[model samples]
Target: MQVAILDDWEDAAARFLAWNDLPASVDVTVFRDHVPDEQELVERLRPFDAVMVMRERTPLPAEVLTRLPNLRLLVSSGGRNASIDMDAATQQGVAVCSVPSPRMSDSVAELTFGLMLSLARGIPQQERGLRSGEWGGTVGISLSGKTIGLLGLGKIGGRVASIAQVFGMRVLAWSERLTDERAEEAGARRVGLEECVRESDFVSIHLRLSDRTKGLLGASLLGLMKPTAYLVNTSRAPIIDTSALADALAERRIAGAALDVFETEPIPTDDPLLALDSGTVLTPHVGYVLDTTYEDFFTGYGEILRAWVEGSPIDALNPEALSRGPGDVRDGDEDRE
Candidate 1:
């Protein structure tokens, strides 16, 4: 069976995650660069029996997925991927499974603090001034007495709250469905959205994307925030409207923002946000990138491919495909579950 790994941007697919579970007989190919369109993806992967995808890199739409008749398994790096159309995979008789994700909050939470400290200390600007022999160029704020607001008290939020305590900063949290128990566990006080936004010196967003969270922070919510405060998003970008954010940043409606994710990734070099000087900090979609995680991610991907060739697929995305049987989807009961 042929196995293909798509969108290995760092060229880490084969080096980090391959060979652990792959069968010697199977041929595995890795594509290091991203293919921009569906046609290229379909043609490149049409011959493979299994495919490994990076998170949200290839948005296997219903049309794009239907073209791959031989594809029996789809493995994504993260356990949860919004890009894949699970229903479409079920219709195509494909088994989509995800790799187990290790706890990834530490790296992102640390980066968040780095950005916060940079902003508070004027690190970026001072570094530039220092190169030109300037001294005491910029003044900055301190985190000692600041109020930090967490938008969601989930895995990453809990970690951030702990770190905030170490800094002697007050921590508050808010989410539509976040429980009071979860907030207390994180050492955060439960506050309404407006209160969290209005009072926080650093507002960090950690919510997952869904109907309720999509476009949750925008013109209305942002307007409620203090102009002296900073907003940090290590979460999905669409959770805040791209245009509204750009407008706020342009008008200096808010002090600054630090972003790790964007509404559209690779976020075109010419994007308006890129032209802003006061965004505080920016990073590509690399909140989850780490050397250690890749080893486990790719190894698991290879396992799913080898299992499919043996007629005993595991961790299928569309479990219903298991009930339809081989050569058809009748035996794809494992997929439905």
Candidate 2:
């Protein structure tokens, strides 16, 4: 069976996992470049029996699904990929499966600190000044005794809150469902969303992307934040309005913003937010791409592929595949009725 692994940027797939151990019957091909247009993606995916996709990078829209009629199975790197059209793939008789997510708390939590420290101490500006032969660089703030606000008390947020305490920063937290007890347990005090943003020295977001959270951080919500406070989002990007965030950063309403995810993956070069030097840190949606985690993701995809070819499929997200009677394998082997 021909399996095409799409969006394997940097060609890290072959080196990271046990691809060579895959059954000789399965021919795996990993493509690094992204196929952005639906027509292009459809064309590229049409010949493959299975395609592995990264989370939310190349959107498998309904249009794209309609064109790839030859596709039988789809695998996403992360267990929960919002990019794939689950309903559409199901209707098209595609078995969608996901790999297990790796333990990735400390990596993101540590990176969040880097963004906060850079913002607080004007690290970027100072570096530029020193490179340009200026001495005093820029004034910066100390983290000790500062108010740190966390917007979610989940695994990643909980770790971040603990680290904030170690830095002598008083931690506060809030979310749509954040409990005071959960906050207290994480060594954080829970507060109203507005209060957390308005009074925080470093406002970090850790909310998930759901109907309740989509566009939750808009102009009004951001307008409530203290002008000196910095906003950090290692979480999903759609949580904040792209336009509104650009406006806030351009105007310096908030000190600076650190973003790991954007509403649109591969943020456009013309994006207005890119123009601002004083108030932004941008990462390519890499809050979860540590080497250790990538190893787990690649290995998980290998398992999913093996189960599909072996007749009894496992982790079938498009659950209907289990009920389909055994079909002929593409390598000219006919199924015994």
Candidate 3:
């Protein structure tokens, strides 16, 4: 079976999985760089019988899925991947599998606070200045007595709320699914979205990207924020309008903003967000990119591949695909049957 691992940008898959230990029948190929063009991606992936993808790095829409005639099994790093077209995969008789990482939420939560603290104290700027033979020139604000508004109170957001209490900060949460009782249990007060934005000293977004959330926070919502308030987004980038944010920061309407994820994975060098003089801390989307998380993902992927080769797929997200038969394996191989 020919297997392709897509988007191993750090080349960490080889270190995490023992490819040689897999059945000798499996031929594994790893692609380290990203291919953004659909035709290029389709041409490159056309030969593989199976493909394993990292979290949403390369979208496998119907346009790409229909082109890969040999593809049988598709494994993703997390329990859910919004990027993949499930309907398309199902219609194509492609079995989709998910590798669940229990540690992902905690890892992202840690980065959320890292960005918040960096913005609050201007840590990155001060560190650069000190390296250039300059002393501390900026005053930092304390987290204590500040009000933090959480956009979503899911596992990661809940963890952030608990940590905020440790810093003596008040937590206000808002989401379509969040209830006052749930907020109370999480030590947060449930409020409307506009109210949360207007009242927060620090607004941190943890909502998933979806049709409803895309462009949710535009100029009007952002204008409601106090000029001293700061914004931090560790979630999907489109949740907030990028152009509106750039305008807000450039005009000094808000104190600053810190982001771990962007609309583009490796933000363009000429992106306006990079040239801003206001307080801004940016990271290359390292929220769930921990050593432990990678180990979990790659290990699960290896197991899934081994099981599929044995003619019994496991951890399938779309069970309907199984009825189509154990996908396009080597013909006339008695062991495969």
Identify the leading candidate in terms of lDDT: 3
Quantify all predictions' global Cα lDDT against the true fold.
Answer: 0.80, 0.81, 0.88
Task: List, residue by residue over 205-251, the lDDT tens digit for candidate 1.
Answer: 88888887889888999988889888888888888888898889899
What are the per-residue Cα lDDT tens digits for candidate 2 across 192-304? 98898888988888877888888878999899888888899888888889789889988889888988887677888887777888778777877767787787778888888
How big is the positional error of residue 254 in model 2, measured in Å on the Cα after superposition? 1.2
Error at 255, model 3, angstroms:
0.8
User: Which residue segments of model 2 deviate by more than 4 Å?
Assistant: 324-337
**lDDT (Cα, tens digit) per residue for candidate 3, span 67-118:** 8888888999977888899877876778999998889888888898898899
Clashing pairs for predicted structure model 2, backbone only: none
User: What is the RMSD, in Å, between candidate 3 and the native fold over all Cα?
Assistant: 5.9
Better of 2 and 3 by TM-score: 3
| Candidate 3 lDDT (Cα, 0 to 1) | 0.88
TM-score of each: 0.91, 0.91, 0.93
Backbone clashes for every candidate come to 24, 0, 0
